[model samples]
Target chain A: MPTRTPMEVSIAVAKAVQQADVDVIAAYPITPQTHIVEHLSELVANGELQAHFMNVESEHSAISAMVGAAAAGASTFTATSSQGLALMHEILFIAASLRLPIVMVVANRALSGPISIWNDHSDIMAERDIGWIQVFCETGQEAYDAILHAFRVVRDPNVVLPMVVNIDGFNLTHVIEPIYLFEQEELGDYLPEHRQSLKLDIDHPITMGPVGIPEVYTEAKKQVEDALINSKQVILAAWQEFGRRFGRAYAPIETYRVEDAQILLMTMGVISRTAMGAVDRLRDAGKPVGLIRCRLWRPFPLPEFREAVRQASIIAVIDRHISLGAHSGPVGQEVRSALYTLPNRPQVFDFVLGLGGRDVTVHDFLEIVELAEQYATQGPPESEYTLIGLREV
Target chain B: MAEKVEKRAIIGWRNLALGCAILEPGSSMHLLTGTWRLQRPVVDPEKCNQCGLCHIYCPDLAMTKTAAGTYEPDLNYCKGCGICAEECPKDAITLVEEKE
Candidate 1:
């Protein structure tokens, strides 16, 4: 049996990577994400983990080094947030297109302009189309378990694409939580050795990342798209196997009290815990309300998402970042797009909140539910999305 | 050489499953670049002192050393970059424009 211990979320993440026995860890330190790589470097220094710990100068070099290491048949892992992730944007696409099974943990943080080191979806949301399988975790345990599950999904022979496990910046990474840590012996049977047939070797030299002219560029992109879309199967299989082994079941769309509700408040990350409280309060008051937390972000889980919201009369999507001038927030736009074809689709109200680590309380969620009800009765909001809990100008 | 052509066809994206972008190791050898040349490098055997400068400088690894120690360019895979001709210590290599 795995031991349940109290540890900081960042420490738990590092321990999970250690158990995964990654061959290389190349990362640059950035706020919120610093503790993850710091613990990993300490593990390498203490010889607790037998791996190459590269203290690269910049995020670009960190990702670049991981790309080379992964290409050379190494089970590679890296952690970054905000600007660090933005710095690696160019290489992130290459890592996916090359089909390198590199796993990354993004301590989701707000992007800079005013220079704030706080939690937000701006970081990962910007890189959504980079073609990596993205999963958001609501807690430290999910973050740790997702790391192990990410490797299994990415390195599968049928699905050799990169993956990113996103955890809210200071909210989850800096918090201490009781998590069940898997022993290496137990994980051995669950996750076998990483085997890649297309690795680089001197004896069998191969040219990778060759120049693709106009003739083959579109086809190359199509191949990558198809691979990313098809990886959903492997992801589902890995999660199912993980549940069977650990007895903690997870799904792409995790619901809370949505069985018989007319109003559904949808959210991602740690904020869902708060939303659940609001749902309980509303239910106690004889209001039909529930919650839907999105776990899978990439390949969108369209069918699962459509089914989750099919019965609700109104859905209030709480977004951590805005899409500027779009009809709704990023998540809201995606939800609306998924339900566009349905004959009797529920009205989705976009609620933008929690930018730059702003505290979102259960009371705030209750207010959002009220606003969503008003919108459903009348028409939708006049603007694209309502900025919730904004200070008076 | 013919086997490489067949291997390229087998490994092409059209034949592989969607999103499988990996190529076989040393697959570049199968990509014949000789036809890409506007000018071909010809070596003057008498001027060649067997210094192997052409072999050391060829960008495509097209130059091969013979049993007798003379460096020869494999025109089939050579793009005729003229790097070997420019770097030749004995001026043994000259680039000749191909006839249209």
Candidate 2:
């Protein structure tokens, strides 16, 4: 809303980062993510944001710089896209293990052998288990808002871990929408201004990053699990607080009109907007269909997901990334895994819809709903993974 | 008769030296003399497996050898960080706690 330009969404987030009073940032420019940190760098250079914005040599070093900065007890941030995020893979795990609570924005883009600089969820899918709360946004507004939510989530005592906000590289990151620029004072109330809980103290010089022996190794991993498990609650609390302060609502798994619906459609990232439109059409035509838009991915919201789709006869998931030779697509696989143990679990199916920035119109989503209807009457298996929109090339 | 209370203290090892299990005086004093005590690793040929893992992993070549090729821990100058013992695959050299 600041300016009509789609790039302003990223700028809004930059302002939020400025307002958040980040102490350090290490960024390397790549498409879709370039404008974000570019504005961030300008903010730092213009004396608007008093922070060390280190322009690193590689994305690897960019994350490495933030890691070192965060470990030394500074609120750190970085933004990157497909190849850049891929390059920072090894250091990503290190950032989480060190409990740095760094925030990053991944302009959700497809990975390459063909080298397409387009939007998809592949890049994030590659690093899902690197121990970060991954949030996907459907609009530029959500993208900006999720940045604040990410900071709150990562910095919370229950979840002292790094977080990534995946905005659709071309769709959400490059789309203009009315995003309310949050006031710093309001943000202070919603998102607490607690600095690092613990950091490098020279008086008590303890060796951080020490090699863990077998005796302490499992305990170290167990601590991370406990913190991450508690993150689900912290994530919801962050969203609720965001809603309270800003009058904008969010959920880990946001359901659209599923109270008495028989069939449900599932989606994530920017595609959920298109899917929601399709669900509205289906509902008007007397099809008992609804939408489940997963706003949060990591520390996957299992209980909420089961409750959202409990009464629904079928749950058709639209995945933007393909996990080749696997059970199904990434989001599709996880959705099933979450609901499989339930006594009255819905018959879940996969619809591997879009990739490399494929345009998934509302009609494509309608096709998914229709397919779910057919499978519902036929009494489908425990679950099935069926890609909806791929003609064998 | 009151039980005689002896005001004496003795520190000793709980494990015996079996085969090549040498628990030389005391080792693993990382908290105390890590910066002061120096003990380079020495390997007894009768027990070593010539694993070469220790040679490769030693950050400081404090884990070196004598002229005849049996590994000797140079204690006079070694920082006694015990990185060598931590890396030794064969577990041949037991660090004698060089008193600080």
Candidate 3:
């Protein structure tokens, strides 16, 4: 039996990584993401977790160290935030292309301009094409569970790619919630030992990440692309098994009150909980409003998403990050593309809100639904994407 | 490694190994980069003096120290960068343009 304990989400994430029995953890301290590695360092020092906790100088070296450790047949882990994640941009592609299953947790935060240490999806949105398996978490329990699931999925023989479990920086990482902690013994056959077949060994020499000249570069890239695309089934299977063992099921696209609904609000990360509340209030007021929370960000989960919003007349995609000149937010852009070929597709109205830790109340969600409905009937808005609550100076 | 096959016969993306990692050890020896060389290093054993500087300075590990205290350059693997010729005190090694 697992013990339910109230703990900060970051510490719970660290505990989950500890429970995964990671061999190497390389990280640089950054706001919101620091507590996770800080706790892991303490655990290692107190003999609670037996692992090499390296306090690297920068996020670039942190990820680089993880790459070396992972390729050398170690279950490696790391965590970072906005600027740290940006610094790791160059090696991020290298980690994915080299097929190293180095699991990471990104405390999603806003990018620097005015320099804010607040929460948003801007950090990870910049890394949309990094080729790693990326997932968003709604709560502390989900973030904890995701860390465990990430190690299992990435280390799988077929899907030996790196993974990132994104928990909204201050929103999710700094919050305290009741998370059920599991014992390593009870994990039993669920997460088996990570044995990388093609690892660097002195006895058995094998060259990894060798130069792929023009003759082989395309093929090598195609392999990574195919691997990510093919990992959908593997991801689903892992989720199903996790549900069967833990009794809490997770899906790529989680829907709320979508039955016979005309308006659907789509969201990701912790804000989905607030969206659900708005959905409930709207339902109580005799409105046909529904909510869709996208748990799986990368690999898109296009078929599942289409099925989720097929019945709705309008989809108001709420994004924490704006794509600047692209007019629509990143999620909104993807939703439009995914629904482009569908028959009688729903109209997608993108709303970029809650940037730099700006508060988004349920009232804001209600307003968004109204705006989306208005746009649906009155053609499109002046701007394809509406920046909600921007005070006009 | 498996009988120098034609480039056209290279395996497709589906058949390529994971991450395109070379699973076979010492597989690079089959590439024979010596074909890329424009000049070849020639050693005059008479002035060689058994200094072994060529063996130390050769970037490609192409120079072998003979049992008779002289160094010989293996033209099959050497790219003829002339590093060995430049470093040799006796100047016994010289870079000559390859004929065909």
Off by over 4 Å in 3: A1-3, B1-4, B26-100
Q: DockQ for each of the predicted structures, in order?
A: 0.19, 0.05, 0.59
Backbone clash pairs in model 1 (N, Cα, C under 3 Å; residues 3+ apart or in different chains), count: 1
The residue ranges of model 2 lying beyond 4 angstroms of the native Cα positions read: A1-7, A378-384, B1-100
* DockQ leaderboard ranking: 3, 1, 2
What does candidate 3's lDDT look like per residue over A64-131, in tens digits?
A: 99999998999999999999999999999999898999999999999998798999999999999999
Q: How do the residues B4-73 of candidate 3 rate in per-residue lDDT, one tens digit apiece?
A: 6333335689877787888876666655566678888888889988878788778888999877878887
Listed for every candidate in order, the interface RMSD values in angstroms are 4.1, 15.2, 0.9
Candidate 1 lDDT over residue span A112-160, tens digit each: 8768799999999999899899999998899999999998888788778
Q: List the residue pairs that clash in candidate 3.
A: none
Reference-based lDDT, residue B53, model 2: 66
Greater-DockQ candidate between 1 and 2: 1
DockQ of 3: 0.59
Top lDDT hit? 3
Q: Is candidate 1 or candidate 3 better by TM-score?
A: 3
- Where does candidate 3 chain A have its weakest 10-residue lDDT segment? A183-192
